[model samples]
Target: MKQTIIITDCPEQQGWQKNRELCMDVTTYLRSDSRMKAGKSYQGVLRRDVTCDEMHYNEQMVFIETSNQKRMKRNPRIFEGEHITITRRDDGSYHPNFRPIHLGPDFNVDHYATEVANELLWGLEGLVDNA
Candidate 1:
């Protein structure tokens, strides 16, 4: 099933870095009319773009680069006008394997993807958080 969501606010970067790569945890401070609960908003990590030379400096960097490469190989980044469509699991269940959405430029395909992913995360049965 495809759900449509309109993002009211752009993602705001949190003060802390999530890893050595300095990727920040961002929060989308907006409520939607979709599956998102009344008080809840979406949260995600901001990706860091590293140069090729930086990857050779440390094992962690190399590993991060390798992992990123592998993930991109499996599911490449969505472009400006393209949205990632995740197929529902068999038996008509929602699986929460969400992907990262590009947040640059106008919030069209990327923003919608992020909002739908948040909806899937917070709305799906047995996955909703009570806290």
Candidate 2:
């Protein structure tokens, strides 16, 4: 299995560069768990123009292993592209779609990112336990 942390903004490089710290943390978090067979290394892809404009839209998606003949219904839905994006903003800072920064819409970039990571890891945990 492969895991990635992609961060994007207007300029692909800027977005990818900015969130490396968070990515490192997430990488460490994932590797520390027993289920991470790949160890601490990760491959990432960042982009400018992306498929989803809103980053917070997909909290987390988990998918079953393709090799499995029968897929079991799991808690976390897995898929691909564990990405984070800054879609809406003002004063040049990323803002959560649910959170407007001032009014506190709902989830900010950091919070939203954390939420996504948690969901993904939680799903992986389910896989490990079931296995």
Candidate 3:
């Protein structure tokens, strides 16, 4: 299945000190047949207006695949009009073309998606029926 997700903001690019992972403000529903409501915890390829040459190196500045305490260096730039086209697999895993950034351990997709949905659905308690 193919789904388009709208990205509004990235806290890490906005100078969020405690934030490390690259989380986006999604404004699309994942499972519902609704547009511009709230996105689900789905991961996919995000196409941005900017490009990043991110690389991970070790203490000796040598490129390594996996490292316990890896050091990463990259030219991080954020631009407007960033969105993603997520591709779903048979195993129900969303794989994006871009690599996942892990600077810290504070970014959670489910938590962020829930927060966005709650914010957008706020003040509409009467409009939506729980039952």
Q: Cα lDDT of model 3 overall?
A: 0.37
Please report the candidate that would top lDDT against the real structure.
1
TM per candidate comes to 0.17, 0.22, 0.17
lDDT at position 131, candidate 2: 62
lDDT of 2 by residue, 31-61 (tens): 2344545554422332232134555432222
Instruction: Give the Cα-based TM-score of candidate 2 against the true structure.
Output: 0.22
- Residues 26-111 of candidate 3: C-alpha lDDT, one tens digit per residue: 33323323342255343323332333456742121111122224343232222111121233455544333232434358878776
Ranking of predictions according to lDDT: 1, 2, 3
For candidate 3, the per-residue lDDT at 25 reads 39
Off by over 4 Å in 2: 1-106
Question: How high a TM-score does candidate 3 get?
Answer: 0.17
Write the number of the candidate with greater lDDT, choosing between 1 and 3. 1
